[model samples]
Target: MQRKEALDILHSKLKKKNLVKHSLACEIGMKRIAEYLGEDADLWGLAGLLHDIDYEEIEDAEEHGKKGASFLKGKLDDKVVKAIERHTGYIEPKSTMDIALYALDPLTGLIIAAMLMHPSKTLAEIDTKFVLKKFKQKGFARGANREQILACEKISIPLDDFVNIVLKAMQEINEELTG
Candidate 1:
C-alpha cells in the first residue's frame, strides 16, 4: 500500500490520542535517524508510522506487534514489517533503521511525557538534559518502558545519544505537530 493510504488507515484505526502521538513521534524520530544514516527517510518514516498498525487488534499486547507484522506482510517491505513487529519487544532488529525504530518507539513516549511536564508543554521547549533526567527517574512515566528505550544501544549508540537525536529531531519539527 502507498504511504498515504497506510497513514490514512492508521489515523482511522488508532483512536487514542496518546497512541497517535507516539506514532507521530516514532515517525519523526526514525526519519531523522534515516537522514543521519543516509538511509531512505520516507521508508523509515512509513515503518515507524505503521509500526503499531494492529496494536489494538490482538488480545495480548505482547503479540500485537508480531501480529501487526504478519498483517503487514506483502503490504509493506519485509524490513518495514519487521520493524513494526519488533517495536513491541517480540524480536530483534537486524538493520540500523530497524534498530533505530525499535529504540525510538518507546523513547519518544518518555520524551513527550517529559515535554508535557514542562511549563510550555512543547517539544520546542524541551532539552536533552531534562529528558535525560526524566529517563533516569523510574517514577516518571513508569509505563514508558525503559528497557525498550535502552534498546537503542543495540546499534552501539548510548541511550542518551539516541534520546538527543530524537529530541533534537522533534524540536526541529515541533511546530508541525504542536501547532
Candidate 2:
C-alpha cells in the first residue's frame, strides 16, 4: 500500500497523539537509515510508521507486532509485514530492513526523551553527544532498549553515527513531531 493509506490505517488504530507522533518519528528515522544504506526509503518509512499499529489495541504487549502484521497482511508487502512483526525484537531480525526497524524504533523514543531533557526541549538544541551520553546512562529513558538501538552495529553503522543520523532525521520533522 501507499504511504497515505498506511498513515490512514495508523490514524484509525492509534487514537493517542503521542503514539502517532512516535510512529512518525520512527518513520523519519527509517527513511534516513534507508537512504544511508541504499535501500528503499518509502518502504522502510511505511514499516516504521505502522510497526506499532496495534500497540493500543493489543492487550498483550508481545502480541503487538504479530497482531499488527495480521491486521495489515493484505494491504502491505510481505517484507513490510515481517519487518513490522520483527520490529519488537521478539523475532530475530533477519533482513536489513528488519534490522533497521528494530534499531530505529526504540532509538526514536530515546532521541525524543533526550530532547525533552534538554534545557531548550527542542531538537535544534540537542546533539549526538548529548544523546550518546544519555544512551550510556542506565537510568535515562530506561524503557528504550539500549541493546535494540545497538542493532545498528550489526549493519556496520557505528552507534555514534547511527544516533546522529536518527537525531538529524527527527530534527527535520521537529515541528510535526513536537508541535
| Candidate No. with top lDDT | 2
Global lDDT of each candidate: 0.81, 0.92
Query: How many residue pairs clash in each candidate at the backbone level?
Result: 0, 0
lDDT per residue (tens digit) for residues 1-179 in model 2:
89889889999999999999999999989999999999889998999899999999898877879999998898888999999999988889999899989998889999889989999999888999999999999999999999999999998889999999999999999899999
Give candidate 1's total backbone clashes. 0
The sequence of per-residue lDDT tens digits that candidate 1 reaches over residues 20-96 is 76777788889888887788888888888888878777788778788778877898888888888876666766777
In model 1, the runs with Cα more than 4 Å from the true position are: none
Model 2: lowest-lDDT 10 consecutive positions: 55-64
- lDDT of residue 14 for candidate 2: 96
- What is the Cα-based lDDT of residue 140 in candidate 1? 98
Highest TM-score model number: 2
TM-score of each: 0.89, 0.98
